[model samples]
Target: MSQHSENTPILEARNLIKVLGGNRVLDSVNLDIGRGRVKVLIGPSGAGKSTLLQCLNFLTPPDSGHILLEGREVNAGSKKELCSFRQQVGMIFQDFNLFDHLSALENVRVALMKVRGMSKLDATERAVAELKRVGLVDRAAHYPANLSGGQKQRVAIARALAMDPKVMLLDEPTSALDPELIGEVLTVIRALAQGGMTMIMATHQISFSASLADEFIFMEKGRIVEHGSPAELLGKGVGSRTQAFCAKISELTGEADGEFRS
Candidate 1:
């Protein structure tokens, strides 16, 4: 897959603001993600990564802002627009939000059968193909309760992939898994990136982001404080706060293969 062109942003956020419980979760946030690029969002726990993802997909309406998807305006003002916006953006959560009662294959088909107006047979074919892409083909008949964390996450990815979305948004996608399980999920993400899928992922895995992301966005105090390629964001003489956070996470990880590997 080719890298998306830099001329037009596939997803753009302008002066986005989101308030929760009277606290500003996202303030004056602005970003432009190139089409088919892999972008990473890194910040402290409360820096608003999750909220920004929600705002992008209409999971949580922003207080005030402009979101342009493929250059079309999507905001909270219009209910009809929100529904359309969601169909174009497929979101994957940290938790595999699967219905325990639904079989893995069923979960993938439900959205397509209901939203895309596809016949049950066609939906099953697409769902099965997506599950195979995520390496969950054999487990498609199993329930969430019977699958491993990695398997469940793969199912979630398949579900999102089945939508054939224009943009993919992930919020802390590896947070709930054990360290060993992280690699399996990241493998699927890397494959997606290699396929030139436009993505915005909020993650704590510095090494993965350092290697995979086309650009990095750093947030603090509910706003984007830095935006650049990974080399630029983690380069020498970066702002003290960003470097400090990076160093701390590096130390915690035990094995460092990033900017501070020396």
Candidate 2:
């Protein structure tokens, strides 16, 4: 990439607004994500973090406002344009949205063949590599029914990775996993971060996120209540919304909130 492109945010959301069932789910939210950055979204259940992520990917189209990819505004209304845009941006849901009938490898390979028009051999090769990346190569032949929750989610991540996305938007990626299985998925995500993947994630894994995220964006009532470096917002003695929320979370989950720094 050129110097200008390298400096620009890989993704931007400007004044994003979204409503559902007569409620403003996303209220004029704005965000910027630079290359190789990790941003974590934290808030209560009804705080609209998921809605903001959905709108960013146009999964749930916004009511108004604009989405810019690499500094260029996107035309979300055009199917062709939206398809092209989505190819560059991946979404990982809390629930592993895998096809039950397809094996792990097939689940990852289908999108490459259908969307990118890759041949069977090439798609198979790419899918195997992705499955290996997520440490699920041994489970490649297994169907969703046969795999554990963590394995299924790994398959989901592999499917998304096959698209070669520029940015990843993950909404509570571990929310569906059992306590014992959460770490496996998180390890994969941590490796992705180490390898310079640009990502925005909404998660309740406070300590884990605080330890890794470049920024903590706290949302409430469909709006961003606070945003700053995790160290500043979550450091000891910081009187911030993120700190208060993390305290409450640490109380409930029994995980210390002190890892937000370094």
Candidate 3:
């Protein structure tokens, strides 16, 4: 790879397509995200935002597409390659996928010991540090059942961060939380963004995303309908799909137009 390619996008998805049950969900999607940049995906429910994220990580492998990391195409045919790819591209789901039997620390520690072959002592120390990063160190002994929605989500973030991924794919991370609990999770995400974490997040938190995202990508009917910086897309009279969608969301959420529109 050339130095320019290495200097550009840290991750790329080219012509990604996925069909399920005779219906095309992700249609020829293309995306590029550079290191330390944050992009937000916005669209209606079932717009294939989740599918795109899953496909990028090969959790739900695309029927046909190319995913490149640092300008090199991903080859997930080998189990070892897939495992390494997944570790590099950490994923956080809407529902906190913590192990029910493990405490917060153990939940973060398990993958390190199992996948990375870290010693138990090393994994435990790393887990403690990650939990502290997410502000959940005090709850390290609590299981998912005992943690609040926000706390569980924090633990999930910590688990992913523990791997030191090159990119983080977030699929509606706050969608499961109650209204009062959403801010805490968003705060953690905001901190990550400020700390230069690369992220591609699919979310409906338009106002929050517009404020933080380097770009807003709008998908509809399994395709990217619009893409641009938040100011370019959401500024008054821009007349973009993203702008209109955000307007509708603002109406539904009862936020003022000024909040979602620049």
Largest lDDT belongs to which candidate?
3
Question: Per-residue lDDT tens digits of candidate 2, residues 92-176?
Answer: 9999899989999999999899999999999999999999999999999999999999988889999999999999999999999
Q: How far does residue 157 in candidate 3 sit from its true spot (Å)?
A: 0.1
Candidate 1 lDDT by residue in tens digits, 48-151: 99999998877887888899987778756788778777888889899989978999999999989988889999999999999999988999899999998988
TM-score of each: 0.94, 0.97, 0.97
TM-score computed on alpha carbons, candidate 1:
0.94
Point out the worst 10-residue segment of candidate 3 by lDDT: 253-262
Estimate the TM-score for candidate 2. 0.97
Residue pairs with backbone atoms closer than 3 Å in model 3 (clashes)? none
Per-residue CA lDDT of candidate 3, range 198-258, in tens? 9999999988888899999999989999999998998887888888888888988877668
C-alpha lDDT score of every prediction, in listed order: 0.87, 0.92, 0.93
Candidate 1 — which residues are off by over 4 angstroms?
A: 1-6, 236-240
